[model samples]
Target: MVRNVESSVDDVYEWLLKKGVSQKISQIFRELLAEHGLKQHISDATHRLGHTLDVLITREDSSILKGIPFVADPGICDNNGNRSGDPLAIRTLLRLSKAPRERRTVIFRKIHDINIDNFRKDLDFSSVTYKEASVEKLIIHYNRVLTATIDVHAPLKSKEIVIRPNTPWFTDDLYSAKRDRRKAERLMRRTNLAVHKDIFNQKCMQVTKLIQHCKSQFYINKIQEIGSDSKQLFKLTNNLMGNTNLSVLLEHDSEIDLASKFGEFFIGKIQKIRENLCSLTKSPTREVVLRADIKFDGIPLEAFEPMSIAEVCDIIGDAPTKSCKLDPIPTNVLKQCSESILPIITEIINKSFSEASVPLDFKKAIVRPLIKRQGLDKDEFKNYRPVSNLPFLSKVLEKAVASRLEKYLNDYQLHDNVQSAYRSSHSTETALLRLHHDITS
Candidate 1:
């Protein structure tokens, strides 16, 4: 049943003969191997004593050992590849199959290429009128109208692309330099000129220097930005050292399940906090109020003043052009079309102010889970934190409400003088400086 073997049978026969074994015995041994569907493939002596002790044995019918040649070396080598004294060494090459290319679908809109003037014109012509209705209905109408307008101008498109590992330091400058280097190399090869050769070498050196500068600058900026955040800094360091790896999943696990698991963990955590608060409220603390005798009558804030169209336009213009998938229009598009959309947005805010209720749509947010830091168990829910990305319009409305609330607080002098958080020109740094001054004085 055996067809072939990849070992030197003739070399083994000669070694057997040199070992003083009879020719008849060697023939019998070969016949026995054939009868058993087995073959010995080691043709050369494996030991220093000229004995073929180490041999590659395989089934004659099997192709697994076929096309594989082994080199029998009498010694080992050091790090510099120089041979050192050793018992023996067998070297062989094993070629493994290439890994399959992984692909993912990217859905995006070409927001940069949009003509803002045309978009504003389209919005001016579009009807966003709604009848007197509940705030919920009005919010739904606003989202639908703006989403439809954006779809007409900048429709979403999907493309499948191969996923590859990339360095964070890679930039457009490096890409252009690499392209120029390729052109120079091609010219050098085609022309066979000394000038072209020198140009190619110079381009190579330039690219190398550019890459080093970019990598160093990337790390330097990253360290400065995250210097105050130790957790983030450690994560960046671990990623740079190549110690971090992606989370692995089992065959039965799906991304949806993982998301649900994270959601449940957060919900349970909030429930625990609520339970603790309820228990504490049932048994009140005996602490005394520090400013119980300081009583000043200040006008209480009952309702928020409605924001005007100009105020709404200013808010949108000043806000960052960061968008979420839930947003009906990208922030930049909204800003550009502010003149046309301000009236509706102003109405929505006024309606919300009079009703004393935020729209349900505004309350919705897309939550993503991220690991708290590197070197933590990725599978554990406690190690991950939830980050909510809210729609751009929701943020605009929030800024409007915060502005009114802040004005009320300032008008009555209701806030504590030493309070640092959420106050203009105040931060932990200022708080620490004040503490230091108090101690010194």
Candidate 2:
């Protein structure tokens, strides 16, 4: 039950006395509370436990109140201090229609055109020991070109560039007023002077009003600038004040803590599995020959076919944008210049197949933990499941590989008719039908 903010412990005892409760029982209750070291709070300049209670009581609907009282900012309750991180200057890079800096894709196209000429002069593909190595070098060069393009990220977001949140409306005047309020508060608390208290209250009101007016004007301007575009407005709003914090908990609420925990879970388990595999006795392996039961003239039997400029352009045009990518230049950026870079991509793809190897960089994935159950303590790592977000380029390359392999397998009828999963035109329904037929027969 929420005790009234104005009521003291003596008032509670007196109220119980009037209610015909025994004095001995009421005294015992007070004694037990003191023995447990539990405390009721009064609001002060340094802490606001009672203020939080007042807000909750005033804001919450009476109809919804149930069970025990719950409070978010129950201040000075325990010695283990709860901390909200020092405020972060979240990036407000609002537009995707235009690059904030010189576009990396354009620079990459220019550099590759230059590099291909220089490469052709000194380095012949035929003379190159490994075509795979050459292709790898080309990709590395592409990354280098992208790296040289200007940094488009917001400067305040960078920790090294230590500018505080510089919202157009939050000015030096407001900051000075806020500082003065804090000074007045400290003076009033120490001296208990009515004059200092009045000064503090005045400063507080001034800061709050100034902040509200400035912020209201700023947001009004942004909305007007965005006009009637609902999607852009929503995106802008989300970027400005969205809950970007991941729900998962790490020991110190640090990225380093998360990484270390994941490393222990994944890498440690993999190492253990490897040790177990090594301990197992060797099993004889056999080479299974693939025979053609069905033939398709369009599908290549011996070698992978090179995708034409038109084919590459079509594929990239249908590519999903705003997806995750490890590379600085995203697939969306690449799609814009797909036609221009087709020759270079075709060369790389053809060489890649001829060499029959891909760089290990393509295997990289970002693991994000998703909460599996809501009520479980977030600090308990097992309650969450990890999801791997593959780079867009890697996914595209993987699809190309899968397409070639599936084509070859389908042409040769390499998989048995019994196979119902991991194939087109086969599903649980088909598997069930086949099972039913066999069972009856």
Best by TM-score: 1
Q: Which ten residues in a row have the lowest lDDT in candidate 2?
A: 150-159
Q: What is the C-alpha RMSD of each candidate to the true structure, in Å?
A: 9.3, 16.2
Model 1 Cα lDDT, one tens digit per residue, 127-194: 44444666677777778877777788789999999998888999999999999999999999999999
Cα-lDDT of candidate 2: 0.60
Candidate 2: residue pairs that collide: none
Give the alpha carbon lDDT tens digit for every residue of 314-411 in model 2: 65566677556476455654565454455555566556666677756666778877778767787776676778887665666666667678877888
Report lDDT (Cα) of residue 355, candidate 2.
67
User: Which run of 10 residues does model 1 get worst, by summed lDDT?
Assistant: 1-10
Q: Count the clashes in each prediction.
A: 1, 0
Q: lDDT of model 2 at residue 75?
A: 30
